[model samples]
Target: MTTKVFTIQPNKRLRAVEEIMKWAHVRHVPVVDERGRLVGIVSHRDLMGAAISTLQVRISEVERLQHNAAVEVRQLMHFPTATIGPDERVQRAAHLMRSLKIGCLPVLEDQHLVGIVTEADLLHIVEELPDASLALRI
Candidate 1:
């Protein structure tokens, strides 16, 4: 899990979100409210999906500009997000993510965003397991 999580405001433009994602090298960003509560989540897949849907209509500069200008984080985010408590077991978090078919989960405490756990994190954990070397031996 990464404690140093990057977040975004709901009102920010989709173009700004794309820039942030690129610069920060993060695929998922949690959306926070004024009180710093996790409200929603946006993923790189969401942006690409939206763009693809629009392009399927007609690929035009004017249409692209309109799409970029009109879209906001609030409109693109996945709402009622599934989250995990920071104290929860990694296995539990992993299970939830698998069942939900989500790539990541925002870690929260008292409804405030604290961290984020992704499939990458789980992969790291698996690699560090005590018996990880056994697979190579066999």
Candidate 2:
């Protein structure tokens, strides 16, 4: 889980979200309300979907920027997001992500957004195990 999670507001432009994701080198970002409560989540996949849904195959870069600028985070974020508690075992997080077909799970504590657990994080755990090869085998 990443404690230094980057978050965005619902009303922010998708362009800003893309900028943050690119600059931070992160694929997922949590959305928060005015009081910092978790509201939604947006992933790189979501950004691509939004762009593809609105743009033509041969659109120019400028047109892409305009489309992203016109859309808000709320328009693309996944709401009522599946979340995991900090105290839960990593296996639970992994199971939820796999069963739900999500790339990440927001970590919540007392209903507050605390961190996030992503597939990469789980892979890191697997890599660190003494018998990592055995775990990876089908």
Candidate 3:
């Protein structure tokens, strides 16, 4: 189970997204509604993809256009989120991530965001566990 997740609102603009990514140094973030329900996820990949596409259309035009300085979180977020309950087994979380092709999940209790689990977090667990690096059966 994961907890202590970071999030943003949907409809946020890309420039604001950059600040959060830069300040937080996070690769991904969950999007949530006003009610705090999970909605979508935004990853560094998503931001970079958007940035690249924006540039590809017309590099000069993009360069001339200034991104919004006061963009809200909602303006630049992804939707249709993937989430899992906090009590679910770690294996279940792993399965959801694998099937969804996502690296993270917003842990929820009822409809509220609670914790977050990521692929790296899972790996860290293994690394911290007793003899987790070993390849042995007892």
Candidate 4:
């Protein structure tokens, strides 16, 4: 799990979110409220969907920037998101992500956003196992 997670506010523009994602090299970002409570989640897939919807035509970079600026994080974020506790086993996090068809799970502690577990994190665990080949076999 990533303890030093990057977060965004609901009122922020999608362009800001995109910039953060690019700068941080992260695909998933948690949304927090004024009190720093977890509110929603945003992913690369959400950004792509928003881009496709807004740029139906081949638009210039300036036009794309304008559209992104007009859209807020709340408009594309997944609210009331599924979350996991920090104390929970990694297997539980993996199961929840798989069952929910989500790419990541926000880690909460005492109702506060503490960290995040992503598909890449799980893959890293698999990669570190002594018998990783066996685990990967169908």
Question: Model 3: per-residue lDDT, tens digit, 46-134?
Answer: 77655635445655544523544444556556663577787888889888889988878878788888878888888877777777556
How many clashing pairs per prediction, in order? 0, 0, 11, 0
RMSD of each: 2.7, 2.0, 3.8, 1.9
Model 1 gets an lDDT of 0.86
Give the whole-model CA lDDT for all candidates, comma-separated: 0.86, 0.90, 0.72, 0.90
Ranking by TM-score: 4, 2, 1, 3
TM-score of 2: 0.91
**lDDT, residue 128, model 3:** 76
lDDT tens digits by residue: candidate 1, 3-122: 999899999878777888899998898999999999899899988876645536767778776777778889889874588898899989989999989999999999899999989899
Higher-ranked by lDDT: 1 or 2:
2
> Mind giving the per-residue lDDT tens digits that candidate 4 earns over 1-138?
989999999999999999999999999989999999999999999999888454468778888899999999999999745899999999999999999898999998998999999999998998887874655456
Per-prediction TM-score to the true structure, in the order listed: 0.85, 0.91, 0.76, 0.92
- Using TM-score as the measure, the top candidate is 4
